[model samples]
Target: MVDSPRIAIDAMGGDTGLAVMLAGAEAAYRQDGALRFLLVGDEAAIREALTRHAELAEASEILHAPDRIAGEDKPSQAIRRAKTTSMGLAIDAVKTGRAGAAVSAGNTGALMAMAKLALRTIKGIDRPALAALLPTLGNNDVVMLDLGANTDCDARNLIQFAVMGAAYARSALELAQPRVALLNIGTEELKGTDEVRDAAAMLRQADYLPLQFTGFIEGDRMSRGDVDVIVCDGFSGNVALKTIEGTARFVADLLRRAFTSSLRSKIGFLISRPATELLRHHLDPNNHNGAIFLGLNGLVVKSHGSANANGVANAIRLAARLVRDDLTRRISEDLANFDTHKGPEAVTA
Candidate 1:
């Protein structure tokens, strides 16, 4: 009976389906005995899965949801079916204060649409951004935002993302006075679009904020580990994120082929197995499994749809950490303190 925050899980959402979700929940419960769960999905399937893990059954409560949003469903289509769907019910748990946060390995667009509609944006936020931790060459992970949430954004939107992203870095990465930057094609002050320039100007003038605004950062410098939080609209952020992931896979495949190409290479690979394993562990997507919908009233973490049990467990842990750390309150407080003239108050009613 270790007491911890309860997280809502959309049990029918992932690629591997209910069994993997339950297995992940069991793994999370085993790793952190304090954590509790609200498993939302088909009651029969959930119960069947739960029987395999008695301890998880003890720690979890199932909420039967007759339907589930599909991976191919568009955001517009998904939002209309919110009431009957597992993803919607999981998010509703957060809205109704029944759960501290919601975790889903579901349709990314659908999850975002449902969350935004159900929880609404935080008072000072214009749009919620999808933020995630990316492994960096430095000592800690870098927080990058608008990973695919808002494809088009203005200067004010970018500024809000900066504040939210910085607050998230503080809460999740345990960083003090995080260094923030805008992602642009060039590092020059005069480069990039008017939106980027305006956002940079605003951030640079925001001296009262807790984060240090380091002007512009080019995409090539992203992995250098100097900046803590990187902000950009969804279009570029998504492209950058996908490019990095593809490059990682390309390098990994090359390594595999090279190692098996020759007998001598295979021998060398055998000798370097330990180092290679360490590299694989570090680069595995499961280690960085959660992508958060920031700027919302509550925490909503979207795990990769194809994630295994280990990845789902990591996502659950992330939601739990944010809940315990009170991430929403921190973001709200930060926004409240922002100058009204330049904040969301100026743009939104």
Candidate 2:
């Protein structure tokens, strides 16, 4: 009987369609009993899925969207059809105040495009960055942003990202004063490009901010958990994100081969099964399934297009958390300070 925000789901937007979406909703409801859902998709298909998930039916409402945006659809094309697409309708629900947040396991680019158009950027934010909680050695996850949204950014843009990222950490991580850093080739102030250095300088001078700017962080040190939030341009951020994911997979595959290479190795694996199980749980992508489009006037969480039920549920849970935290409002208040510190010229420049 915990009352919480209602979330809008693009039920037809995921790879597995109605069944997976409904299953994810059910799982999320079980995890967070406070959740309510607005399932958007073809009514008949959603109803069919509901038949298989009675618990979700009681906690959900159906909103029919006959059209869907395909994986290959361009953002331009998707935005044009936003009024009819399931993804678009879900975003609209947030803009129209019917839902607190929206979650979609759809085309990343299209979702970004449609969300930017519908939600728009919060005042003083020139762009929105894709941010997510990356598991770190520390007990908590680190916030990394500009995962693939802008590709290229200026000093001002990086500064904006830093502000947005800090706001996110405050909301999602519940940190009163999150330590922030800029990703650089080296830790020295003289290292890295002009944009990163400039962003660092601006952050250092912003005395009014709540977050602590700890200066430059080398790429190699990202997982050490010393920094609470990491800021980078999209190109570098995307590369770093992919490298982490690839490395994780490569290690997993190597472990599998090593464990099965011989009978003695297999025996050792069995003896160490519990430890390996813990490693598996920590490395699982489903545990960190939501990538938030921060800086938008309304919150939108993008699920991995191929995410399974568990992954989708994690995404939905993330959306609900952001809603309850009032992430957008927090970002807006901080963004205003960012503009004040930078002045009109620096912000517009």
Candidate 3:
């Protein structure tokens, strides 16, 4: 039997609390029986929850945490309590090598802060970016980065994001040479802020990199099925991600209302039920639940605080896959190749 890496989970982190977290872990265990878990939270609560999942209970171990990071807590405040909180202990497991990766459905800011502080950035990486998979009309999902990690970034930061985003796409999407584009106001070379244009220029010049720099892509064209990786600063990227998610919900809700408007519409809905179901599945956030903190020395996956058992299971599965694939080493190798080929100099020139 293949020995899968043990995943450390913040059992008390999400809005739904321990029951959902344990259920999610159990679901993942059912999918991959070889998977193991290190559950971090109030020991009595975790133990109580596990009793309902006998198989998962046998496959898991619990670590007691006296505290929990509240949703309103600031990152700084959370950091001070790192050694005692479930979220903090989960991340520390990755840092100490007790777990291959950490997964938490907690405050985004606190999770990012704790993970960065605990794992630090990879050798050549200056900052880690939040990257996630967005459903697109394309054959594969698109990889978008800087999803609220760094609000303000320079040309160099954007360039680095492009590289890391590409590496993530290659690993998660299994692309040979991901087509990358800078998210901009327009596709015109002269459009967008100075940092964006500069990043585009640098990407265009760096032919030695594994990614194919396809110039700037507009926000409206993000889901057009052409680009594989979209790079932007946290300010713009966060706004874009939220907008995309909101629009998806809007469309899904609109369709439901429209189909129930009248008998005729309801009959039509039944006729198109198959198509609508596919569309619903495509827009479901649970299908794509994990957002990764790329460039960190160790892997850390952020699950939506409101995510359900299936969503949490998806996050756990994602963390396991990233560990098995050795994603951090892959990014480090690509970063080294970029430096060795004088990519920075080429970009500056």
Highest lDDT against the true fold, candidate: 1
Backbone clashes in model 1, listed as residue pairs: none
Residue by residue across 106-142, what tens digits does model 1's lDDT show?
Answer: 9998999899999999987889999999998999889
lDDT of the candidates, in the order given: 0.91, 0.90, 0.90
Report how far residue 35 has shifted in candidate 1, in Å.
0.7
lDDT of 3 by residue, 106-214 (tens): 9999999999999999877778899999989878999999999999988888888888899888878889899999999988888999999888887787898899999
Give the worst 10-residue stretch by lDDT in candidate 2: 340-349
Q: How close is candidate 3 to the true structure, as a TM-score?
A: 0.96
Residue ranges of candidate 3 with Cα displaced over 4 Å: 1-3, 343-349
Q: Encode model 2's per-residue lDDT on 278-311: one tens digit a residue.
A: 9999988889899999988898999987888999
C-alpha lDDT of candidate 1 relative to the true structure: 0.91
